[model samples]
Target: MLATPPPYPSTIVTSTNHPEPPQITIKPVDRRRILASLAATITPFFSPHYPHLNSDQFPHIPVSFLPVANARGLFQMPPVRLSNRYFLVRAGESEFESLGIINTNPVAKTSVDNGLSTIGKKQTVKAALRLKEMGACDNSCWIWPSITQRAYQAAEIIAAVNGVNRSNIVPEYSFLDARGLGAYEGKALQSVSEIYASDLVSPDIKPPPINDGTPNESVADVFVRVTQLMSILETQYSEDTVIIVSPDSDNLTILQAGLVGLDLRRHSELAFEPGEVRFFDPSSIPTYKQPASALYKCPNPPSCK
Candidate 1:
């Protein structure tokens, strides 16, 4: 039998407009103990069958075949965790013709009216309602920091539509924010594409040059950060579901990384429209060498294709 998890530290704070702020509970795991148990159980299962299999035919033996200490060490490493289900949603569209341009352009201005258009808000609400109908609202919601205003607003709408309190919404910075576009910000979508034509067309990963006086992050940087975050989330919420709201380009990058295990250079192959939503199982993500084509084979909207 599994031991009971220790009570996690939780606190409640009151807001001026609302009686209470959203509640956040964090449960810490005993990594060493878990790894030890896993190694012990897995070793015995594989030990009896090893001699029956041909090592020459199967060059990559299971981790369980390793010594107990080695197995434990491998299990204890980072970026490995039990699988968890998650939902990814793109933020509603703003005035920008294409994604990322507005964020990259320092001169561009954003306000309640211009940031999320009326149609964008409606689409987000509809997407949230669809999730709620599908029982996804039971899980906590996480939104990207850059699009907090619109993302949180959509979360609030979701909570209201689901007849649940809005305390489950949280903000995360792991999602690639538009500011990473640097000099591309504020420029027309076509102009930005023209500037980075070589980078976009090249089969190899070629990160765009950083513009002066702007924060710049490459596709690889975002991939690494998001993958680390996925490892942590899977471990912490192994049996629970969660939602993530982010921008289109950022969402596509994450989806491509998770579904195909492709390098950052292939990020353009996958795309997402504003307010689009998709389901994913973080634990089952395969490596690039083991491509899972079926996961990403579904038809997409015109923009996504």
Candidate 2:
């Protein structure tokens, strides 16, 4: 009479034996993060072992001085060549003062006689300017005067013109003597009839003759002394250099010697004018003139000893 009831079979439920599934939690990612971050940064620099441009490149620059017409590989110019160490300025003329010894009348020893004239001053300025034009001012330079005021004044003008500091000028007296030159100082061929003379000494004083001639320096003394000065300069500067002044033709002689590797022919005196300067070649030298009186050097002649 009533609805049929469904059958409930399979298994009976027990409360103590049944278990529930475990839950898992997850965190959300924030667009704006509050967490601290550690970021590493790097910077760059030049290496310490890099080479300098000037040192790496200067050797490739063309040599400023070229060879002369007569001499091969020797450099000579009116204006001196530029260099890092030295620039040589050859001063002509006798110094206005002497080293305690007077060559002229005592009355002629006044300041006017001892100093540079207006023309001489101008010449000195011109010489310096010429050197600058030739590029001698890139490094330290010197103004060297013979032991005389005239040379000193000329040197001063040159220093001022060349922009050389006063401290760079030095006084050198080595060219003043004839042990450096001896009896040849003031003697002159006063008359056209006068001939060149020599200071012949007794055989006792003269050294025995050698292939290069008796030990008397002849003109070689000037060459040796000049070479010595230049050697000193080479050590100090390692560049072309100028020695501002010297007495008579001493500076010229030295320069000529250094360039030619031989003695200079002293045809005339080197006079002072401020603007006047001479340049010499260091590599090529002239040959020395043999004197008629010089005895044959050796029995063997040793291949042009």
Candidate with best lDDT: 1
Q: What is the TM-score (0 to 1) of candidate 1?
A: 0.56
Per-residue alpha-carbon lDDT of model 1 for 6-37, expressed as tens digits?
A: 56666556676776765767778899867755
Model 2 per-residue lDDT at 53: 23
lDDT of each: 0.55, 0.44
Collision pairs in model 1: 104-185, 105-185, 105-186
lDDT at 85, model 2 = 37
Model 2 Cα displacement at 136 (Å)? 1.7
Stretches off by above 4 angstroms in model 2 are 1-112, 176-218, 263-275, 282-305
Candidate 2: C-alpha RMSD after superposition: 25.6
